[model samples]
Target: MSDSDPVKGKYAAFFRGCPVEAELLLSDIDSERIFDSIADALTETGYIVLPAALPLGISDALFTRIASFEDDVFRPAGVGRAAEFQLNPFVRNDEIRWLSSGDEVEAQYLAWMEKLRVGLNRRLFMGLFDYECHFARYMPGAFYKKHVDAFKGRTNRVLSTVFYLNPNWAVDDGGHLVMYEDSVEPIAKISPLMGTLVVFLSDRFPHEVTTASRLRYSIAGWFRVNTNLGPHIDPPQ
Candidate 1:
């Protein structure tokens, strides 16, 4: 079946930032169906949200596995600073520590992510050449400053997908995902909902993670194409 065969509609105005919000309104979208809808949505809105995309049990399992690696993650200071402010745990090679830990739970999580990649391409018309997954953990008071995922000479980062895993999260707990609307003054906030997938244009949106009162965990990464890339390359400066 094609993307048009499934549900289609404009999401709330809040989601329609300067870029786009292409949403699939299906009650139960299987992996293949989701892939198609996502691809179509990306073409128009530069992003899409898949609510309840995965089973709750599976989602819980994935988050549990991530929590197991709290110590193994290479936590680095200097994340949120104007030049360097907060702490960050970035796994660059995917061959050390947590990635190489080989715990059953971690293995299961990787397998599920691989399955997601296959589904995305088969269902959404995306090429699976340089796609990768990265896990993120934000402790209480931790925040990621606003920044674009794509850099000049490294435009292969076509899209960014974030799967929020914080269950029973409250507004007072903070750590909301904030995206500036059209590079304007007022910003839009998206609550971190369990099992909800947020996809958006990697190059266009300047976004950041607000400080959290409690621990916040999520699987955040980008979809990319193969290209020789450069480091910290500013857009025009």
Candidate 2:
């Protein structure tokens, strides 16, 4: 889509807080050309949602490949009072093997990451970005409490991105992504649409994954800066 697209104008306002919901921007954007426009929107607001970023067929293929390794994945803990499932490819434990496993999914993830990095750099004037993919499966009643992606000793994470893989999700599905913006009240809720991509600032906002009525599949990850130092960078307040 061109910069002059009405969706672009709507997104500019949405990001600036003139519009409270993102559905306003989706009206004029073509799902097929979402990559570029969404990138532009993200540059100003630190977040963007492309209503239909992928086709059903491609989304299904990618989800199938991700599900094939369910048993080998390691789930996260300590974020909530109750058990909330999370799979991380960058975990420090031995239980989680082969970060990418050199599989077709890994290759696809790498390519997608490259494209995201290019878009981010072009729009936000940021460069040298890196990322890792993690699959999250939330079953009925499972939920992730509010938390920030970057913590007290880590700030290398520049942005966080999540691609929803579930199909036919509805408002009653209960798997919306809740984000707390600059205010203490009025949280933002994003629908978990198949092929929909959500990007946002990794350190500035606190977010959570709500309970699911059924199974919820998503590729949740972060983009970081490559540095000679380790993973203990100071967190941004």
Candidate 3:
């Protein structure tokens, strides 16, 4: 943040004497501006697609981390949750490895997301309790059928986010995320370019990944509200 930053500038006096944790971020990235824009777009259109949104260094580091993983680290992705989870290759052919802060690079990415969660909560007034994410890899010819991340009051997932890590991606790469509304025709087709970020209401749009010509990489995450009450939990142990 700079002396001329609008978010910090506008709230400087209001947040004067506040603890360092109160601030959105201490990173060199323009997080305040980017997060504010995301909040605004989500408010107006329920979704927003940003190209090259992340800082170059962080993006490159994340890409390197996921790319260096061994094949055995990932497991075939499945539908549903916990006991309801089951593999079906027809629905999705990709593999994923859940993210955790134990690793340095993964911790860095999650730290940024934690800041984003706070920013969105402050702006949107939503009870976003936490976030969970995974690295998804679509190998050559792999694809995922259209599906929504959440369904109204049934799921804890409130907002979904996807960050692309494929550097030097081309239009002919053949792996595009297609979003849909009420119409049968798709509304948007997004290329998996490095540093691109996509955010949307988890229940609002049905989306799918097209067949990949080569390896496609991305981080898929969700902001969730706590659903733990007494004997029942959102994710059963």
Please report the candidate that would top TM-score against the real structure.
3
Per-candidate Cα lDDT values, in order, are: 0.60, 0.62, 0.84
Q: Where is the poorest 10-residue window by lDDT in model 1?
A: 6-15
Query: TM-score for all predictions?
Result: 0.67, 0.68, 0.86
Score candidate 3 by TM-score against the native.
0.86
How accurate locally is residue 124 in candidate 2, as Cα lDDT from 0 to 100? 61
Pairwise TM-score winner, candidates 2 and 3:
3
Candidate 3, clashing residue pairs? none
TM-score of candidate 2 relative to the true fold: 0.68
Residue-level lDDT of model 1, residues 101-198, one tens digit each, is: 14443443444444456566666656644445556777777677677777655466766888878889999998888886485663558888788888
Model 3 per-residue lDDT at 190: 95
Clashes of 2: 0
Candidate 3 displacement at residue 166 in angstroms: 0.6
Report backbone clashes per prediction.
Answer: 9, 0, 0
Across residues 65-156, which tens digit of lDDT does each residue of candidate 2 receive?
65666654745433311244345323211122223524544444444455556556766677535676667776576677677887534556
